[model samples]
Target: MALFEQIRVRLPRGARADAALAGGVFVLVAFPEGKLLGHGGDPLPSRVVSWLLVIVVCGALLFRRRYPVAVGWFTVVGTGAYYVLSDVDGPLVLVPIVALYAIAAQGRMQAAIAMAAAMVIGVGAATLTTASDVTGTAVFMLTGWLVAVVALGSGRHGRLAYAEEEARLRATEERLRIARELHDVIGHNISMINVQSGAALHRLKKDPAQAEAALSAIKAGSRDTLQELRATLDVLRRVDEDAPRAPTPGLARVDTLVGSANLAGLAVRIERTGAERALPARVDLAAYRIVQESLTNVARHSGAGHVTIRLAYGDRELTVAVEDDGRMTARPARPGGGSGIAGMTERARALGGELAAGPRPEGGFVVRARLPYGITGERWSGAADDQGPAGG
Candidate 1:
């Protein structure tokens, strides 16, 4: 079956090829031994009529894809007429087999089955002809061949449907990924801006200097937000020739993020260990967003005095951990749905990684993710793990 599928895949998938193939089948079936069916029949008129019927039956097959059921039934009726009239059996079997296959492939299973049964009965009916030499064994062989052709056509139809479904699934996943990117970029930056502007409003009259600083921070954050928005929206700008794209933020910008968090009243410390190595673009982006979302959660939910962000580079993996000395309320989600952590989890799994986010053993919340560097490599310990790196 696999070998047959490979051959079918390699065949030219075009109307021209199908027409040529049908024409070839017609030649072989209509002109056996340089003469039409019943080559030595006493009645030349009957033989000519039989040959014309075979030609007409095979001719309908050229439009099998467009009108499968119509052509299939036409071929079946024409072949039946020829077999009843012609003295010789000829190669009438090929026409109905091809036609039934086309009908079944077009999702007309009932019609194809009915036609196949009719052809079998037609074979039995032809036995009444004095010139027709169709034996019981010959009828059985033709019937079995017809059944196989229907089965093959059904298989081909199923494969085509499966391929289309897979394409739709891919398109859905792409849309979801784009939505996640938009949410992460906009949510994180806007949260910081909201906190800063609120501070500015609260201290505007009492301390103009502090208010001015907060407003300046909001301005900077908004500019960063616009750049990140442009980067996020680039996925939808593939068709735009004039769309300008910005660099995507990665771990290199973690320090910038820490600075922004500090300005938003969260004291965050960054710790880096292990030799840094280049990461794939997806891995880099995932790592950055995970940390960003984690910190945003901390700023919003965690009432911790200080937070620690750790970046660990290992031989086979890279890990990032964000732990805040905050307490979780009864509410299970952030401002929006619980999609923040869910998105981070999806990103890690997409890269063949795992994420852990929960309350720490001590008294705070921790979010840690471990992303592998290569396809075939040992797993590495997460940043919050106490058992050291994997393979150590």
Candidate 2:
């Protein structure tokens, strides 16, 4: 088997040479009487013609691999002619067998079968005409050549199957990797914004001056978050030339997001807990989207008068929760009921995190998500607050 594998590897460049050498050897061995110089006890022109036939048969063997179908037919004709003219069993007769196997391996099964049939008919006719004892030779050659074609074809198909399976596995792995990165970028940002926005609102009643500054900070933070998201999305979209340019929103932008809801006459509140820390880009992005999608759902379905968003960071994970105090009966059915929920679930699942969204026991609807910190053990620290809130 190892020797056969080595020969198969070398066959691409060496097949033609091998065929020529084998035919030369056959000619020398078959015409041991010095090319039949004399016939019926005297020299004749037929002797020279017979030698020429051997040369033609050997020459035809050189082109088999480059054009296997043509070579098979040429060999069939040449071998039959040589068998009749020279009364010789030349090695050129095996050319069609190799050519048929090549054709079948290359997915040309019908052509290979046709050539095999031609070989059988030609060999049978030549054997009958010459009255030679070729019955065993003919049977062995036909059966062996057919088996070789079937084996080669099956091997080629198996190789293709393996290649396809490998490609599929690679594609699946890539998708999982991308999903993890996306979760890290989006999750952390949304948590931070939700926290800060809630703090700003709480301080509004106590100090109007600080409230104005906080609102301004919120707008700037939201804008910055959107820009950063756009940049990250651009990198992910490298494979798509026509992908749209849309910025991603992060948690720092929750105030502006909630403000928009306020403008639409929905009362929204945001709150945060724990010491604020800078998160990886993926976590920030996921956090922002969770809040954003939650608020969007509230606007679309709920006739809620108030919505509350909360963000909390523990030692190992970040959690986000959004709830509304709207009456369930007042909420309308979502235009496409399950699509938004499915999309949200898919987004959360991609990040290697968990999301929960449904009606709250007290009243209204709720969305909760928890994302793990320390992606692959990479720790993220808080950035300096020197820049404006919009500079994330």
Candidate 3:
């Protein structure tokens, strides 16, 4: 069985070789039978013609793989003609039967079926007219043809189904990858913006100056964040339409970000060191988010009276530390407690960076991040001087 399966898996050389070999074997076997024509009250010339026809019919099998339908028709016609010419049973009939099976297995079902029906009718007509044992021939021809049709159809259907299932799985995996990227990009910025906006609104009336400042900070953060997000999304979208045009916020926006926090009532002070060379897009976005989220946390969780943002740009790395003087005892419970920190950590790790957030030894919360600046040295040169209003 295993040996047969191996042989079945191999590709055929083509119809010509197949036809020649099969015809040669049938001719060699049927050659001696020419004498039976005169002894059995058979027409000697008709029997000789049938033997030659069998040899000719063998060629039909050769073309079966390349043109199964045409081969099947040739086999049916040759076998039918042989049946009318001779009383002898020869290997000629089996050639077309194999062709019929090939048609059912590899050709379209409608074509296979139509050819199969014709084969059945032709074989049945031949068997009834010439063969002595009509009963056995009738049953074998019909049953074998039907079996071939069913087996071939089933195999083709199974292969098509497996291909479709594989395609579906691949598409599902791609969609999941896109979804994860979108969440990481959009979720982090929107959360920080929401937290900061809430803080700004809460402190608005009591300290109008701080409230206006918070509002302004909210506006600027949202505008830049939205622009940055749109730019990132544009990369993912197809190029059928015009690409979205929105500037991304980089390290240069840190001053405006800190100024907004100052206006929101969190007295923010910023210190920068090193030549502010351009950074990679990813690193720039990461640095911006780290500052935004850290300040948001200070405003929302740290009961700090003041916050400080310290940025150090080195040749190979960029570092940011946000420390606040808020009292831990007076800090309100964070909504969805601590998941935000985990999300921030994930964001940092994605860029081969690190984030440290904890209660400071000096009695407040501190968020620090270290981002490698290796390849991202291009300074983002488009920071606008006019800080936008805070988003609602």
Candidate 4:
């Protein structure tokens, strides 16, 4: 058995498999058909014609996948010719059944049904005029076999279609995830660098020391951005084992965001309530991205001088909120204006959580999110309207 398996494994797939199938079917049908015809008093000339017809029917199977309906009709016609010329029942009928299966597997159910009907009717009609012993039971049994073959092929087609769709969805989700990660990683640092560079230029002439400090902050922010960028890109090159690895950003790195926000001239404060404990990786990352994107929006759009970052750990969930005492501006809407809020909300919801981003009732803008412990929940009806003035 093991040696047989080794030989099977070495056999090429696809067309080669079809060729082997045709050869096997020819051997099974041609040999038995010749003996049956000879035993039934068929002359040598008639037997030779019967063998050639069998060869033609079996050989048509080689192109079953490429031209399933065409091959099916050819085999059906060839089988009918074989029956008309010879008086013996033979296994050549199985070839057209195989062709029917191939047609159904190619998602041609209409053609398969039509061919099956034709064959059944043809056989029934042949039994009336021919001297053969085909009975009603035999015709019914053939119908059952044909139905089973078509059903199996159709089932295989459905399964393959479903799997392909699932693969496409997974690919789309992965792309969106990567895009969100890149945006969060680069947007915050770039905002900080932009502010720091402006500060450095403004102070370059007056206070050289302050300008030097601003330049140093820009350098630090640039370095952090590059490192984070590398880490994010490393995930895409999953084949590289020796790539420089950095810890994935999570709630543990909230302080880094606070520091960057401070460098951008926003006085940032972090407040935590309830019991603090380790969180699932997905929750940790989602919370971190929410905070990071909030700070980015504040720096870019909100003219807020003070921002508060809040984290409240509950019994079953974690709440992350960022509020800023910033002025609201009637900024003209642009393409991709609120992508940050959308991404943050998607991240929260993907982990069975919810997020809300809108203006605080009293004044400034606020972005809040709730992440659950379990990774399953009903979807929230949060929309893009939840995006506030600070939306990036």
Better of 1 and 4 by TM-score: 4
TM-score of each: 0.74, 0.46, 0.45, 0.88
Highest-lDDT candidate: 4
Q: Estimate, for each residue in 74-148, the C-alpha lDDT of model 1 and write its tens digit.
A: 988888887667665678768878888878887789998999999898777767655456788988998889889
| Winner of 1 and 4 under lDDT | 4
For residues 1-392, what per-residue lDDT tens digits would candidate 2 score against the true structure?
99887778543347757576546645664565363454354345555555676566556557655776786677667667766765434454554555566667766667777777777776677577767778868667766767777578757867877888987876775554344333333433343355447657877799776667667655765665676566656555567364333434467767767765664446888788997787655566667667776776676567688999999987777888989977763334344333445545555555567788878889898888877664442221111111112224
**Ten-residue segment with the worst summed lDDT in candidate 2?**
380-389
lDDT of each: 0.75, 0.62, 0.63, 0.79
Residue-by-residue lDDT tens digits, candidate 4, 82-189:
888855668889899888888888789999999999999999998887766898899999989999999998999899899999879767766666667667777778
Residue runs of model 1 more than 4 Å from their true location after superposition: 1-67, 86-94, 107-114, 128-130, 135-148, 239-248, 280-282, 327-331, 335-338, 375-392
Quote the positional error of residue 213 for candidate 1 in Å: 3.0
Kindly provide the TM-score of model 3 when superposed on the true structure, using C-alpha atoms: 0.45
Q: In candidate 4, where is summed lDDT lowest over 10 consecutive residues? A: 383-392
Candidate 2 RMSD to the correct structure: 11.3
lDDT value, candidate 2, whole model = 0.62
TM-score of 2: 0.46
Top candidate on TM-score is: 4
